[model samples]
Target chain A: MTRPSPKIGVYGFTGCAGDQLMILNCEDQLVDLFGATEIRSFVMAKSDNHEAELDVALVEGSISTEAQLKHLKDIRERSKVLIAIGTCACWGGPQAMKLGDGKFEERYKKVYGNAKITVSKAIEGQPLDAFVKVDMKIPGCPIDKQEFLKSVSKLVAGKHPYLLKSPVCLECKWKENKCLLLDGKFCAGPLTKGGCGAVCPSHNLPCVGCWGPTDDLNVSAEYDLLKEKGFVPEEIITKIRKFGGSGVMELVKNLEKKEAKK
Target chain B: MMILKMKKEDLPAFLESAKEWGELWGPTTKDGKTSYAKVDSLSQMDLKATRTVIPPKKFLYPPRFTMFDFDEEGFVERTGDVPKRILFGLHPCDVHGILIMDKLFLETYKDPYYAERREKTLLLGHSCIPDDKCMCFATNTDFVAEGFDLFFTDLKMFYLVWVGSSKGHDLVRMRADLFSRNLDKNDILNYTEYRKWKTAQFKAKIDLTGMPDIFELGYNSPIWDELGEKCLSCGQCSMVCPTCNCYNVVDEVDLGTAEGTRDRFWDSCMFREYSVVAGGHNFRDKRADRLRLWYTHKLQAFIGEFGKPACVGCGRCVATCPVDINVATVSTALKEQEVGK
Candidate 1:
């Protein structure tokens, strides 16, 4: 008996919708991929999408509204495997920066002076995993297409694909690219996750930690390095929070405290 | 040494013919960044490039090289396959870097991988006009005395070539039509004048007056702490360094098949795991300690072993560092510091 294709759904909440566009950008391979996987729901790609039991759910963007949160819970319940794609979904992106900074309400007023968002109850941005279980995370500003494709294929085959746990420095060294940090340019490559193929460094640019912190992140080393480079604690904290999310920000605080005591 | 002249226009034809010798690697421009790349024709060679972001050391010591392929039966180790390769447009400082690297790799424990490449490769050196960041003159490596097969000095109208080796002599013999033996006393004087002019261009110099003693004495100096504070531990300084030869080897097995390949890639001392041993005993755990080791290795330790510092004064480290950590400035700072008598 011929088995039915895996029911896969694509989604977005509060983001630039760039990650979904990245999937569409795979124009050449999308046709073959569509033939293999049963795309049950994909708002960005098609208007004719139905809510159904999904084998896999590829999610992008941060949850910033009460409506989005309820919808996310529904999707989570329907999907067997939920994959967080992009920095927005994995770590809440730039929208969630203020949540940790303790200036969310003030910034909200600054953007919309006393005006309440009517479409949905406005709430602070949070990653999908904060409310639901995320089986895997494909991290990047706009998730890397190759990595996304690889993860999707592996999940479809019921195989657990082991992603790189190392930092960008590993691939940068492998590419033989000169370090921008050595040139007195601030780079987050040493602490940020690899699998981006060291793209920024290959072009002689610094990594901005868009892919988030590596598993073996030496927080103290990075903090001390930034501090040595004349970056103040506040400035370094801001840099870390850019893509690291609240967890890393907390780790940064701990590292700072240890540094201060020393 | 045989002296010859090749016109500026004839360089392309010469490089095209040089392909008959081996695969050619020279400077090429892409996305506003100029770097050393394999060239098929003269047009691909960016001869006017100041310096590549990373040196041509990758050709000799690649970032990731397969040591050997193995099966379940037994393991086999093989030397580097760097077939007859000619690296053109290398500057004098970089040429000197390879010579210094030779002292380390070719010493008591000869590295078969490096040796295989060294034996098969030919270096073509060129006189460099120093820019603001260049400190080769300070390190006394601006002009190479030896270690290159061919050295080319740019004279206004033509290139004044000096055949430094029998390999270069054979090239001159093989491509006799490309060169002119019509050299006079004026050419020598012109070359000397040009060298002096180029030497005067380098304003940056690392004064070694008491640097050796200063480096030795300043082991416990607070400067190391300051360096550690600013250093990002990115290891880019060593990556761009032509003389640095540190590497790590790992066995990678193909998941589908039982076959595997032992591969070696560039490793940096700045890494936290570089000094980590079994049972997680990290010797150089602190950033300051790692900084001290790097500076001391390049300045003091290398001098003790090779009678010269490991730094070739290519200034790639100084120029590439994101934090503007200038080695020359650091040395000068150390020299000027008043240590406890």
Candidate 2:
């Protein structure tokens, strides 16, 4: 017998709320999703959101604080499936830049400057999976609607989410845009995942590696491409480390040593 | 392939014939720039402009269209009967832009909204004599010339009208008084010669050969950091492009009520927030990366699949960029980069 509709909950943390807004922006599909499932919670859209057991909990934003970490633990307890929605939850978002800024208190004091940070405290940002096992990640700064819907439908039907294994380069190919990289304009599509349907490229612009690094992406090859384009080691290396940070820094250390050997 | 002649003065009767179907929209003055607007008087149409500041895609895929509205009862599609109209005075680049849209809306997932609008409207393409920035010829997309219903090639005092569709032929029949006797071979030759001269008038050109190879090498290129520093993330390049079609959908609800209207608005990759998903995986987490993505997708990799550059080379990006970062300049820079030694 088909079980009753799975209860789904959507939450947002301290990002631009673009991701949650995007889900609500899926107005047509939102109607169908509501009818198809028991929406246990959605704070951004609806007032009546539950903090109880959920089939799926799509958390957006980074757990940047002790309180947020506790809440993430609770969400993991109640959620059978934890789906990280935006960049913050997936790859620590833009705020992840603070990882290199040393301690949070120093920067926090600098930003707040003797003024009380009476709100929740924060630490360096990290992806949600660092705290709790993320069942699936629908990556985008704000997830693409069509792709999001497909993932949601699949999950609700008790199926594994279909990840976009293709690189941003593939989708850019589909959009038929000019290659900014080819024009000596540095772009990072070659190593980024495809999900945004190559939106940036279609607009006569470049991909910024927003979907984060994909498994199987030829990062070394892309590095070589950027190097050949006459990009400085400082610039290209900085671009690569924006998301991966320490991981990339470590990778670069190895590369530098390898190059030194040559 | 029939060529007919019409005096520049008889443009009124032709527009009047267009009104019999739906609204007649052409390039008109708006916000100190030429934009495609609904027009009645022929005097309001700016036929002399290079291209409209706003794209013709607005007519087909409007930025703020309500795809649907929702309340407790159910969801209701906001479908209005499409009004047949004549979209006239489009430059070659804009015309090419619309054809790309036709491919997008019709050939792909089949957007009913655009298809409905397309079925109702008649496209009238006006050949561009081209200005200093035109590079459609360099991209080899000056014209396959298939998208428009009617094509008008201006030959001095007279207009060479090429009936591109049955609708165009019907339009001519309906407005018979506007035309003189059918044109001979000389008009076609003269128009072709004029087009060739117009292509040559462009001040910039880039050899787009092996762009993928060049781009494949440039992935680690340092040029992005230098150029990205100039990108203010203001999204002006996207806002002005004839073919930049990225968008974000939003829901506008009243304070007291949950009911709302959903609207699709144009969005740009340049926005810091464009890629920030709910859980926060900013794949392109850096300005440099976003900048790189914009250029590579346009000239290098998009060609790997689409068989043509996504850019129509309307130079709207050049015209509108606040920083004056020109693609022509960038492409020339790419040409300068040599492969690995």
Candidate 3:
């Protein structure tokens, strides 16, 4: 008896499309992917794609326009499992960073001042979860490929994906690498999630908190440490707010008060 | 193990004798900096030298070597066979990095390209002749360890060599009377003293004792943003790092045919495109995170893995980085923070 292959589709939105490229990056497992299941749609990888009800739909990019909102709702309706891939889809990626500093009209003016812009009306770009419920999220600017394939293959086999959140600091420990802390190398491995295999540190650099803060973290303590280093409260908040943006703004107030003491 | 003291006059003979075993590649002076490349004459081998600009890992894992040739039709071909070559003149820090990479390639996915080359090759280590740029002592990698067949220490006219494996003994056996004939406690102690002298020469100016406290506090330090403004994102800091092994795997078509190879080449997380997704989503999209990620991995996360920082403290990143983002300066700033805290 032959079993029916699952229908899977991949979609993208308004971004550099590097995350999807990262998936295509798995050259070895790609053939295995084609062999395992029926790829219903993947705009960048293939031209011939179906848009019917999908067993699993992997989406990247954010909701920047009304068209994207309608498309996301349709995806949510049709797909059994909707996995948001990359930070923009999972958490508002880079574009979401400029929330408060200015209005869209002003910022747009600054970039394309007073031009009759008829491209797409701005609608505060947000993660997919904002428009439609996300079953699971594979975070990162572009999620790590090994984990991505494992999830896709698992889904194809009718298994749940194993999401990792052990923190980049844990992988650092696993490698038996020296703690940059002892050398006074201020690092956020404790706060940020792992799965990148500590690539930054291996290059004699520190973690920039790109993987996003772990679920269980002491953000305040790190704040205190920075203050002790004589760093300004505004500077520290702006740095972390790069990835976490609004998620981190609330924490900035406490930091500023601490800096006021001295 | 037998050892013989080769007279300074017989250095060329020693070089020629070693060639019978295999092609010996050591430190050759290029533009006055010690770089590992093929050499024919003994004078070309900077016997008394500074550290090589690049680690010998490049020989096994070339910066952009092809992994294999593959085709659109799935005709997978692998270039797993590596030539038998001898790599000499590795500093202790570099030797340590080689051992770490051995764990990466030999253990996990069984990287045939790295492992195949590594298995067929011999490793030779040399002690450091202290220089202002050298920082092995900062990471405690100044002393020789395993991963080398022959370990050479410069003792003025004569070289103190330690044969680690069978290969080392074979090299020593080839030269009957040139190397020291017998090993005694005194000779071992003399070498130990030389290593200690080398350590004193480096004398890591900043103590690494209070790293955790300093780093924990420096987590929100303003130095990163200040430095981020100057960064070019060229990834030079990552390129010259001995332990930095991030790579990008790519598929290419062979000639005009569908037959091509999938290969993994060195990649840096610093590049803006490193974390970008096809959907235009970038998690660490900010320049600060890129800068922060580099230091965090080296300082905090690397410590969690290997119980040592990933950086060899070679200052190559500082030298090569277009922005001059020096880890030493960062560490000093953290030290001051620890005191302030």
lDDT of each: 0.78, 0.71, 0.68
Q: Which portions of model 3 show Cα errors greater than 4 Å?
A: A1-262, B1-8, B183-189, B254-256, B337-341
| B-chain TM-scores per prediction | 0.93, 0.91, 0.88
User: What lDDT tens digits, residue by residue, belong to model 3 across residues B7-67?
Assistant: 5576678667878877878887654456777788676788566666566777778766666
Q: What share of the true interface contacts does each candidate keep?
A: 0.21, 0.00, 0.00
Return the TM-score for each candidate structure: 0.71, 0.57, 0.55
- Give per-model CA RMSD: 6.9, 10.2, 10.9
Most accurate candidate by TM-score: 1
TM accuracy, model 2: 0.57
Rank by TM-score (best first): 1, 2, 3
Q: What lDDT tens digits, residue by residue, belong to model 1 across residues B41-131?
A: 8688777766787787877777778888887688887774567888888998888889977877788788778888888888998777688
Stretches off by above 4 angstroms in model 1 are A1-170, A173-187, A200-206, A214-239, A254-262, B76-83, B180-183, B338-341
For candidate 2, write residues B22-78 as lDDT tens digits. Answer: 788888765445777788877898887776656787778774477778764667877
Model 2 chain A TM-score equals 0.89
List, residue by residue over A1-262, the lDDT tens digit for candidate 3: 1346778888998666878899889888777777667889998999988899998888998888888888889988999999988877876676766555557667767887767768666677777887788998887766788778766755654545555454565445333344453345666655565667777765557777776655434456555555555666666666665665434444545555665776
